[model samples]
Target: MAHRFQYTVISILSAVLQKCGLRCTRKFGKMLGLLLMLQTKRRMITYDNISKAYPGHSDEWKGALVRGAYVNLGITFAEMLYSKALSADDLINQVTFSGLDVVAERARNGLPSILLSGHFGNWEYLAMAAGVCLHKPLTIVVHPQHNAYLDAELNTIRTRFGNIVVPMHKAARTLVRTIQEGGIVAFLADQHASADHDPQIEFFGRPTPTYSAPAALALKFNVPMFLGTAVRHDTGKYSVNVQPVPSADLSDNPESVIELTHRHVAMLESEIRANPHLWSWQHRRWRM
Candidate 1:
């Protein structure tokens, strides 16, 4: 009953967002972002994150970035709500692709790859748009939302355009199989991986815990890897950049895993630094 009610609320929000269309949804979602910014605790988490990353910045600047981060998140959610109503053409038309030659070459040679991105921009579309663009689907690893009903509802959008979804915990076998089959697999490497056993990487100049599985797996399988992100423009249009991560030359070993992890994490950090607003700052990503 609780899960059903939660989903009902999301459905209501989705309806409103869908009706607004892309441009208007950006406007509407910012309004929602303003409201979300009022939540003191989470807002501070966002603010603190910004401050830690940019210690020299003035309070006003950090505040504005924090606000923009929430607004970015709001817009991401608004855009996602519209996914259910989008056909393949609608999805493809709204997003432009860049730096895709690497993926194209891999496809031509029947090779598998590890696609990685952070929580920046419309990361969902990063994996979604690649399929029809290349005529090959991707296996995407996802974190399961606690709300089982909402999880299914959200994943429905993910799979609608010919992608396979695997929850993080049970994804090991599927990931191995996909690589062996010469299929692409995607993972978001920005989320917190806080287990004591988890390896730490330098993120934003701090020793931050990160998900290293993507790097480890890529090294283990000796697969080519790429990092990509979807940048949502003010007009609500998006441009995706899929750049090669230069992993093929690395020998598959423990040291290689760490090096690959650092490389991808640095790429994401640079993206966030370039556009702080596009990345989510709400997570307790860094320890004080």
Candidate 2:
């Protein structure tokens, strides 16, 4: 009953938001950020985490990043609201892609590859752009919100360009089947996970729980794994860089999966270091 009510409220809110213009979306995000900053414990945790990660930075510098993170989050939400209205040409003009050959090589071999990325820089746009560039629909694993109406609406927008959005609950089976059937699967690996689901891995010099599903699937199917990141440039444009993960023959044991996962996370860490402001710092990524 509570879930149903939540869904109804979200549906109405989404409808209202959709009708509102871009200005309204931006305002909504700002209002949300203000509320989160004022009431959420997560805000302080995020600020402290950023400070700890960059010890040498001044307090003012760290505060700027925190504010930027919230602003980016607002932009992300606004983008999500109108992502379907965006066209391939618009995305192409806004986003630059590097390492096409890496994706092309995998596609040429008739073996599907697992593309792993994090929640950075309007991730929805990145998936849509991938579908456009690859000329094939990319299957994304997503954890839908509890609100059913909002979830459905959001999924509709996400799959507007024909990319499939699979629910996380059935992701493993769906991913394996997609790979076996020669379909590309993309994973967003930076989300916080339960300790049991994802063991602690070093991220930003701290032990953060990270998902290993991408590594496990890549190794199990002997498919290539690629590291991709979408970074927001100063002019409100995005650049996506895809790199091939180090080849690992994973015939040995399950522990090999953990090592491969760490390598991918390490690569992501390097990218984050290069531009800490673009990364999602609002997440309570580390427990302590």
For each candidate in the order shown, give its overall lDDT on alpha carbons.
0.84, 0.80
Number of the top-ranking candidate, with TM-score as the measure: 1
- Give the alpha carbon lDDT tens digit for every residue of 87-117 in model 2: 7887667677898567766676766988888
lDDT score at residue 217, model 1, on the 0-100 scale:
88
Model 1, residue pairs in steric clash: none
By summed lDDT, the worst window of 10 consecutive residues in model 2 runs over 247-256
Model 1, C-alpha of 54: deviation from truth (Å): 0.3
Candidate 1 per-residue C-alpha lDDT over 93-136 given as tens digits, one digit per residue, 9 for 90 to 100? 98888987788778778899888888888888667778767778
Global Cα lDDT for candidate 2: 0.80
Q: What is candidate 2's CA lDDT for residue 100?
A: 59
